[model samples]
Target: MGRIVALDFGMKRTGMAHTDEMQLIASGLTTVATPELIPFLVDYLKTETVDVLVVGEPKQMDNSASESEELIQAFLKKLKAACPDLNVARQDERFTSKLAVQSMVASGMKKKKRQDKALVDEISAVLILQAYLDRKPFI
Candidate 1:
């Protein structure tokens, strides 16, 4: 099976995560600058067999769209234009940053390391991928 990639996109930085070829578990990938994101994915896809691209869809606590949805939608448009044949999916991303921080604390990560926003973004991407995996039906 091909890998499944997830993206936690932000204004300046974007977090990335992907499952292994077996697609069994999700792992933190990397954080890239927003401007370079599309090119990076395009190059990565040339080398990797990615089956799906899951993007974090920000939502408010009341299930309304988040303030940054427009940004994401713009990004998605660029992504789709770049990889027209690519399969893309969206997963609701709520409280992922908070959960990532709690997880780091539970794992005994030092405050200095946990405070790294890039790391948090990466972890949040992993969480987003994991949540998508949990809801996917087994074949």
Candidate 2:
């Protein structure tokens, strides 16, 4: 079996997470600057076989797509073009960042660590991937 990856894409930074080949657990991989993503993913994929790509889909409380949808869609298109065989999926990521912050506080992380947006994003990506894994029997 191949691994699955999740992405929390942003304008400035992008968070990444992945599951083991067995797909039993999700773990944070890294947070990379947006400009460095494609190369990072390309190099990462050289050693890892990614079966699917799960991207965070931002939405409003009323279930409407947020402004980030357009940007994500564009990125998805580029991703698909770059890796035609890879399946891409999206999961709703409404309050993941807020939840990540709360989790950090609850875990007794130092205030300085809790304030790291990249770390928060990475955790959010892990949460997103976990949610997806919970829903799919294949995972």
Candidate 3:
């Protein structure tokens, strides 16, 4: 079986996570610069087996798409162009960063460590993937 991958894409950095072949648990993978994300994903895909690409779809409190939606859409288009065979999906990414910060605090992570934006990004990616996993059963 192939694994499911998730992405928390940002303007400056992009975070990634993936599930095991059984798709049981999701874990943080890495953070890459925004400009390098496609290349990074391509290289990773060349070596690993990925089934689905779950991207975080940011939305506002009123349920409308966030300003970043345009960027995400463009990125998604580029990603599809680069990997036509891959299946791409989207999951609601509301309050993921806030939840990531709370999780770090609850886990007793150091202040310095919690201040690392890349770390937060990675954790957010994990949350995005976990949400997908949780909803997979109903869908």
Candidate 4:
């Protein structure tokens, strides 16, 4: 009924993506500075109808929590406190950045664009949301 938002939380910049109101397609939104992420989300939610949030959880190749997990956990806590009625979920984000680069290369994106970290982050958010949408069980 409402849009599903996904976030690729990074230390420097955070990426965002969202689904249509019907939750059919996942599209890249934008990358925001890490410090401005919460404010940006708060502002966006004020104007949009978000049913659920899918945040990318960084993990190591050995399935262990990455060093950034603590930061992400803190952010999650902040988000939960800020939006108690919102449903928030996490999706494994291993290799998402690598996959984004590979996808960009395969798609023949220009070198300048492919090198843009913001674009990579946005694409990573899209990938994370698509994975969540593909795997979530909707009743």
List pairs with backbone clashes in candidate 3: none
Q: Higher TM-score: candidate 1 or 2? A: 1
lDDT of 3 at 36: 98
Ranking under lDDT, best-scoring first?
Answer: 1, 3, 4, 2
Candidate 1 TM-score, C-alpha based: 0.98
RMSD to truth, every model:
0.6, 1.1, 1.2, 1.0
Give the alpha carbon lDDT tens digit for every residue of 15-38 in model 1. 999999989899999999999999
lDDT of 3: 0.95
User: Which pairs of residues collide in model 4?
Assistant: none
**lDDT of every model, 2 decimals:** 0.95, 0.90, 0.95, 0.94
Off by over 4 Å in 4: none
Q: 1-139, model 3: which lDDT tens digit per residue?
A: 7899999999999889999988899999999999999999899899989989999999999999999999999998999899999999999999999999999999999999999999999999999999999999732
Residue 119's lDDT in candidate 3: 93
lDDT of 2 by residue, 12-38 (tens): 999999999988899999999988887
Q: Candidate 1: what lDDT? A: 0.95
User: Considering lDDT, which of the candidate structures 2 and 4 is the better prediction for this target?
Assistant: 4
Comparison by lDDT, 1 against 4, better one? 1
